[model samples]
Structure formats: C-alpha cells, structure tokens
Target: MLIYNMWPMWVIVVAVFLYLSIKSYKERNAKDVIILMTVVIIFSFLTVRSVNWLYGWNIF
Candidate 1:
C-alpha cells in the first residue's frame, strides 16, 4: 500500500544528495560538486517521471 508510494523515500534521498552537494562545495573541487548536482537532478527528474507513469498523473 503506502510502501508502494515511494515519493517520501525519494525526498530523503534528495535531502542526502543536497547535504553531500553542500559538503562537497565547501570541501571538495568544483567539478566534483557539479557532477554530483547533475546526477542528483537527473535522478530526481527520473523519479518524478516514473511516478507520473505509474499513477498516470500529470502533476509534474
């Protein structure tokens, strides 16, 4: 049931990605941070797309 709705888990994953991005920005190189952010953005986009496909929703 509710477990099938995984948007909440995605939220947590996004939060962790944001935290790592910020940490990398402060302590790591620019290219690494950019790559991390790009990966996270694509991951989020795919997640939303998959959810839309699953529920036939046009929310995005």
Candidate 2:
C-alpha cells in the first residue's frame, strides 16, 4: 500500500502566494507585498514542520 501526502495543498498555497506576490509587485503595493510575503514565509515554515512531524522527525 502506498500513502499519499497532502501535496496538493502545498501546491495551492505556493501558487497563491506567488500569484499574490506578483500581483502586488505589478500594482506597486509594497506594503501588501510585504504582508503577503510574510504570510507565505509563515505558511512555508508550518508546512515544513508538519511534514517533519508526519515523517517522525524532530524539528523542534
């Protein structure tokens, strides 16, 4: 038996982050871009931590 992980969720999150970042940059919304980037970073960190936990790795 093969186990499938939540790869789709990660893809969606990354895609949305990139889209928003590019949109903000094109519109010259520096503040929004910063906020969006911060959110993306936080989510990325959480994703890594969750994956590590799921794989029985001690990240903390």
Candidate 3:
C-alpha cells in the first residue's frame, strides 16, 4: 500500500486534535480536555481503520 495516499488525511486529523487539546488545556478545563482527548483517540482510530479497510489492509 502506498502510504502517501493515506497519511495526509490522518495527519490533518491529528493536527486538529492537537490544536483543540492545546486550546482546552489553556482554558484550564480538565473535563473538556479529558473528553476531547478521548474523542480524538477514538475518532482517529476509527477513521484510520476505516481507511485501511477501504484499501483492503488488515490492521489487526
């Protein structure tokens, strides 16, 4: 599989998550930061897995 075809979108997703996480941290809202971090992880996993499936890649 060609990584270039897949990595860009994932990079963007991670970048956005990082930005949001930083913002939440600066606001000193522990709850939002925790929830946002959890959501970022779950969403990133699901999205990457979805892309892998589409490319017939066995992520497991």
- What is the lDDT of every predicted structure here? 0.78, 0.76, 0.75
For TM-score, the strongest prediction is 2
Minimal lDDT window, size 10, model 2: 1-10
Which runs in model 3 stand beyond 4 Å of their true positions? Answer: 1-17
Query: Which candidate leads the pack in lDDT?
Result: 1
Backbone clash pairs for candidate 2 read none
lDDT tens string, model 1, 1-60? 454477667767777887889899999678878987987897688678768867899978
Better structure of 1 and 2 per lDDT: 1
Number of the candidate with higher TM-score, 1 or 2: 2
| Each model's backbone clash number | 0, 0, 0
Which runs of model 1 end up more than 4 angstroms from their true locations?
A: 1-12
Error at 18, model 1, angstroms: 2.1
TM-score of 2: 0.69
Per-model TM-score versus the true fold:
0.66, 0.69, 0.61
| Ten contiguous residues with the weakest lDDT in model 1 | 1-10
Better of 2 and 3 by TM-score: 2
> Judged by lDDT against the true structure, how good is candidate 1?
0.78
